[model samples]
Target: MVPTTITLHNTGNPLSPAANERGWLTNPANPRQASFHIVVDEREAIECIPLSENAWHAGDGSGSKSGNRTSIGVEICESGNYAKTLDNAVKLVAGMLKDRGWGVDRLRRHWDWSKKICPRLMYDDGKWTGWIDFKNRVNAELKGADNVKLDSEKVNVIVNGKKIKDGKLENGVTYVPLRAVGDALGATIGFDNKTKTATLDMKV
Candidate 1:
């Protein structure tokens, strides 16, 4: 049966984990399975399974093409599963949203369009349901991630105990090595193996 017209307004709050698992995975191949887009299991070190393909997770709702062509899905396996997977799932989904310029509104649960709670989870309330949450999370993560420092920024030059040349600058970063600069300045530059420093002999 073609699934479509799954409502989200004024829906049932939720059920216990045990009950959730039963209804969530009840049919395994159930049409509503795709509703929860992100399925996370926190038992191990954090596993993320994506449902970018069609999942028979959506029940007989309005848009139940099994999400093959339309929706993106994520399934995570975890232990102590009291929304533990929420953080990671949000990250993964945020990455997807950012990369594809999608909004949290695009981050839908199976029940949003069909008659099931495949993911059986939500972020706070509808406030974090769509692309807004996805974008915000991605920006936060991008800001916190380790930045790539350019090697060029560390290069400076000294000759005859005096600073004469500056390293070649690119993109506001420097890359000119001491030897290169000294040689350009008509100085015989050599590497001192013992001192581990570049020695420049200039015609003073």
Candidate 2:
């Protein structure tokens, strides 16, 4: 299932390095039943699991409609620099929102899914206001971004003086559907599963 929401988490162990956290989650012998999609630190972000599959990060138990089944989990490391860690998290989350075609409204705290106070720094001492601040930052990152824009304005496509299809404008760029382009050009498009390459045969 395509992830519809993003869940934030904190490593909880303030001393555990980001590499060690990644190792623990990925180690075959550790046998810890917990996992997350990505772990972010002040230095870099590490992906432990594929976004296409659900991770056991959310406190929500096994269920059909649980956050674990539908949302992507991101754990922010609390090691080294606190401010840098938050900066990295904000960048990572903004990129995810851009890639997934989601807005800041889709962002959720771990507490929103369960009773856990994960991402402790953002929720501690009744500081839920921090979440709102984070969302605002994400929204700022999204403006004029490279992601697709969901707009109602239709862009008409013309080929050889004939209107073929309609496209959409994203960040001032007009993007036409690939299939539409192929059809307009009178080319046969084929995909190779093994090589994952798209082939256009103009002779056909």
The most accurate candidate by lDDT is 2
Q: Which stretches of candidate 2 lie over 4 Å from their true place?
A: 28-31, 144-204
**Structural similarity to truth (TM-score) of each candidate:** 0.37, 0.67
lDDT string for model 2 (1-204, tens) is: 568899998899888767889899757788779889998888989888899998988878878788999889999888898767876788889989998788988998899999688778766355454565566657767885334355635789997676765777766788764545666787655544346555556753
Worst 10 residues of 1 by lDDT: 2-11
- How many angstroms is residue 148 displaced in model 2 relative to the true structure, after the best TM-score fit? 23
Worst 10 residues of 2 by lDDT: 144-153
Quote the positional error of residue 156 for candidate 1 in Å: 42
Q: Identify the runs in model 1 with alpha carbons over 4 angstroms from their true place.
A: 1-38, 43-52, 60-68, 76-78, 81-83, 115-119, 123-204
